[model samples]
Target: MKAIVCTGYGPPEVLQMQDVEKPRPADNEVLVKVHATTVSMGDHRIRSFTVPSAVWLPARMALGLTRPRRNILGIELAGEVEAVGGQVQRFKKGDRVFAATLQGFGAYAQYRCISEDGPVAAKPRNLTYEEAAAVPIGARTALHYLRKANVQSGQDVLIYGASGSVGTYAVQMAKHFGANVTAVCSTANVELTQSLGADAVIDYTADDFTTRPDRYDVVFDTVGKASFGDCMKVLKSGGSYLNCTPVLPSIQVMRAKLSGAHKLILGEAPPETAEALDFIRELLEAGKIRVVVDRKYRFDEIVEAHRYVDQGRKKGNVVISIV
Candidate 1:
């Protein structure tokens, strides 16, 4: 199996392509022949060790003190099941599936084995492998925070950075959750966000989005460029402020929920974070959601994809086809 192995954590260049032994399914696992996967912001963050010092310390304990515990760096994948363990009941050898690989993180390889109980789901019939591969990570994150926000139909929800992988899904899912969506992004992504069912668009380059007179019932800051305090000013009295970034202040906001204003919300999506994957899969299968692929890269070009995503201007997801 050809896999992208991270020799050490520093730059995208550290991800070296090598032929590694293919994994076999365990008694309760399924072996998947990966057709497509994604090079997400999470992948970059892990590969480069770009997390906050507080978060990094814990992550280092989990990943490794010196190098990563897991060598291959990928999570989201869409592919066909090549074989299933004897105990597997929900899937068979030919079942098409899409899933997030949690800590098992080996989707950068040509094959991966995942437990049937993992975030695995039947791939939506309407989507291509590339499209399905892009869903799990970003969609799960969006779903996690929106549920935290408890979005209501008539209430206004503002999605800052409503153009990134998670932001695009956040916009659409919030609309699906019945909120009137307002997307804040650059002029280039205005149409893309609006097309995803955003009721209004704010060009951040031309306007201070916080100054808008219409306060929102929920404000989701997907980019983390805005502070919780800054976002709260644009929220209605009881509105919640949600951020995707894993910054220290966001962690404090999460802790503050124990004593202080639950109004400021911080979303910490857990690994294997499949709690929201089922909902996202249903929405996709029902045609209520769509995957937004800003670009597609081959396995060999993954480092380039990382570079593009690191530029901080991607309109949507960046896919990497594994097959």
Candidate 2:
């Protein structure tokens, strides 16, 4: 099987294509022949080893000192099940599935062995492998944080970076949760955000969202570009602030927590689960949520794909087609 291996933590150039041993399933796993996968922020962060200097040592220790603990750097995939373990009854050899590998990180390969009970589920009938591959991580992250905040009907929700993967999902998910959604992004993404159901769109380049008089019940910084103080200023009392790319907690974040004036919800996304995948699958199947794919690349073009994602300009998901 062919796979893209991360030689070390540095730049996109470190990712190399090589022939590797194909993976087989365990008694509780399913072997999938990957048809598509994504170059996500997870791949970017791990390959580039970007983090705050404060947590640099700890992050290094957790990932790798000189290389990634998991060298193949893909977190999500969609494919056909080529084989299933003896104990697996929910899936068969021909079932179309999408899965989140997360920290296990082997989706860059032609084959992956995923736990039958993990974040793997039937692909939505309406989506292709390329579209389904982009769902697991982004959708789950958006759903988790929105639920954590217990976003309610009639509340105003603002999403920064609303054109990116997690941001796009957060925009749609907030709407599905009945909140009035406000999307913030570059001028290029205003229409895209509106198409996803954001009630209002703010172009960060043209104006700062913080200067607006209206306050929001929930403010989600999907790409970590929005300032904490600026977001805090616009957050209504008792609202929640969600950060998809969280850094060290600041004094204001702590103060808000101590005073019970606001809540800061940030960090790694919740571990993927079969239940979560099933829920997202239902939404996808029902057309309650939509997959936003910014671009697609051939499997052999993985390096080019990585370079594009590295630019931080991807509107939604960038998919790598494999077979």
Candidate 3:
């Protein structure tokens, strides 16, 4: 098997391709031959060690003392099951699947082994390998946060940074939940956001969303580009504010909690589960949601893919074809 190993963490250049032994399934695991995967923000953050200052020490300790604890650096993949252990009854040797590796982070390879009951599920019948690969991380993140905020049907919802990976999914998910979705992105992404079912699109480059008189029942900052105070001003009383990025605790969070008028939601992402993956698959199959792949790169061109994502210009997901 071939894998891209992170030779310590610094830049995209640190990712080196080399021949490695193919992983085999354990007694209760399934061995997948990876066909496609993604270069996610989480992967970039880990590769460059670009984390919040408040978590610098803990990040370093969890990732590695001086380098990455894990060499391969991908969090999700879509692949075909090549072999399955005797205990793996849900999947067979030829089943196609998509899954989030989560903290396991070893998808930048040709083969991976996951437990039978892990965060893996059959790929949606309507999606290709590349498209399915893009779903686990972005969809799961958006779904988890939106559910946590208790998004209700017919309520107003605003998504900041609505052009990025999680933001793109959040827009569609918010709509699926019956919220009147307002997407805030740069000028170039206005149409793209609208096409994803946003009731209104705000060009953040030309205008500030908080300045408008309109208020939202829920404000989700997918990129953490907006301050809690700014978002709070536009949130309806008793509404919720969700922050997806990692940042130090803010006075606004404390104030919100104390005032009890608006709730501040920020914390670690929910763990990926098989049920979540299956839910996403159902949505995909039903045409309620779809993946927006910004670009595709060959497995050997992972460095180039990373460079593109690092530019912060990709509209949606950046996929790496592994097979």
Which residue runs of candidate 2 sit more than 4 Å off their true CA positions?
A: none
Worst 10 contiguous positions by lDDT, candidate 2: 266-275
Give the lDDT ranking, best first.
2, 3, 1
RMSD of model 2 against the true structure: 1.1
Instruction: At residue 33, give the lDDT of candidate 1.
Output: 98
Give the C-alpha lDDT of model 3: 0.91
TM-score of model 2 (CA atoms): 0.98
Clashes of 2: 0
Ranking by TM-score: 2, 3, 1
In candidate 3, what are the lDDT values of residues 281-314, reduced to their tens digit? 9998999998999999999999999999888888
Question: Where does model 3 exceed 4 Å of error?
Answer: none
lDDT of each: 0.85, 0.91, 0.91
Better of 1 and 3 by lDDT: 3
On a 0 to 1 TM-score scale, where does candidate 1 land against the true structure? 0.93
- Judged by whole-model lDDT over C-alpha atoms, candidate 1 comes out at 0.85
Residue-level lDDT of model 1, residues 1-323, one tens digit each, is 89999888887888899989988899899999999999887788788888777777898998877778898989889999999998999899999989988566888999999988878888888899999999988888888888877887898999999999889999999988898999999999989998999999999999888677888888898978876666767777667878877657546466556545546655576446344666777888899989999999998999898888778798789999988
